[model samples]
Target: MSYMKEFTKGLVKENPTLVSLLGMCPTLAITITVQNALGMGAAATFVLLCSNIAISLLKKIIPSQVRLPAYIVIIAGFVTFVGMILQAFLPDIYDALGIYLPLITVNCIILGRAEMFASKNGVGASALDGLGMGLGFTLAMLAVSSVREIIGNGSWFGIKLAPDFIQPMTIFIMPAGGFFVLGCVIALVNRISDRNAPVRTGCAACPNKDGCAGCGTDSDVKEAK
Candidate 1:
């Protein structure tokens, strides 16, 4: 495939959070507010871009047996770098991100891109994929967090939307709200994306209901729903 096609796949086709549904932990954990969501997204993007580039550049030199570990180290190094940068430059974000920043090391989005795309693709293509996926993830997180914050807190970036008697949901500003918003956004996006296009549902590899996991094997899977 052309480089553009390779890159675009990560944006909408294989969007890390929206389509693939990977990296739910950070997505749900940091999306309580728009700022937190944006911070986590940017940090993940930086890590994803750097790791994909490094993995693509050294894919051939690294033995297949140790590729996974090598990728983890590369990803972890970038995450740590972002952590320090945030701490020094954006102390507020750094403090808010907290332990979640370290969690970026294990974010499936980074590892999945490195193993599935970066390892076999060219550096340019890998970089593009990383950027696309990073941006997509960021968009998803922003979408969910924005809705939550607007309704749950009656504010967007600290500006109140509902004036008087606007008692916020309150829950939308908490951890549980994150999951609720995430699931709702995913479902909403899926519906919109599938409306005009022929869509398939169900997870072929899963033992439970279809679309339970992030895998896209649902295309050929048979389902009752």
Candidate 2:
């Protein structure tokens, strides 16, 4: 695939949060405000970019049997770097993000790409994939946080949107609000994509690209038969 395709797929086609539904923890937690979303998004993106590049560069050297552990160590290093940077310069965001910031080390989106794309692709391609996926994740955060912040707090990015005469729905800013807003956003995305299909737990449409374990293909089924 072209470099542009590598980058563009993450934006909407296989958005980590929206389409793939990878990182729901941060998606629902820190997105109560746009500022928090921006911070988390930027931090996670930086980690993803750095980790993907490192993994791609070391792919040839990493033994196949130990690639997963090696990838985790690489990803953890970047995540720690990002956390320290945030704690030193952006203390407020760092505090607000709290443990969730460190939890990015285990974010499914980052690990999924490391395994499915970066490990197999060239450095340039892996970097683009990381950038694309990061942006897609950020966009999803912004979308959910913006809606919640506005309706829940009557504010956008901490600026009051509704006049003092109108009261905001407190529930929108709470955990319940996150779920409601996320569901709406997902539905909207599905509608725009012309797919109103029912949700399924199966990995039939997973974007793992290379292949996902336990999601046997026709060949595997035939072999068993």
Per-model C-alpha lDDT, please?
Answer: 0.83, 0.90
Q: Where does candidate 1 stray beyond 4 Å?
A: 195-225
Give the per-residue lDDT digits (tens) of candidate 2, residues 1-225. Answer: 899999999999888899888999999999999999998899899999999999999999999899999999999999999889988998998998899899999998999999988998999999999999999999999999999999998999989889998999999989999999999999999889887563643345556536476467746644775
**Clashing pairs in model 2?**
none
Per-structure clash totals for the candidates: 1, 0
Over 4 Å off, model 2: 196-204, 213-215, 218-225
Provide C-alpha RMSD values for all models, in order: 4.8, 2.9
lDDT of 1 by residue, 107-201 (tens): 99899888777888889998988998899899888999899999888888767788878789999988888888888987887787673333544
lDDT for model 1: 0.83
By summed lDDT, which 10 consecutive residues of candidate 2 come out lowest?
Answer: 200-209
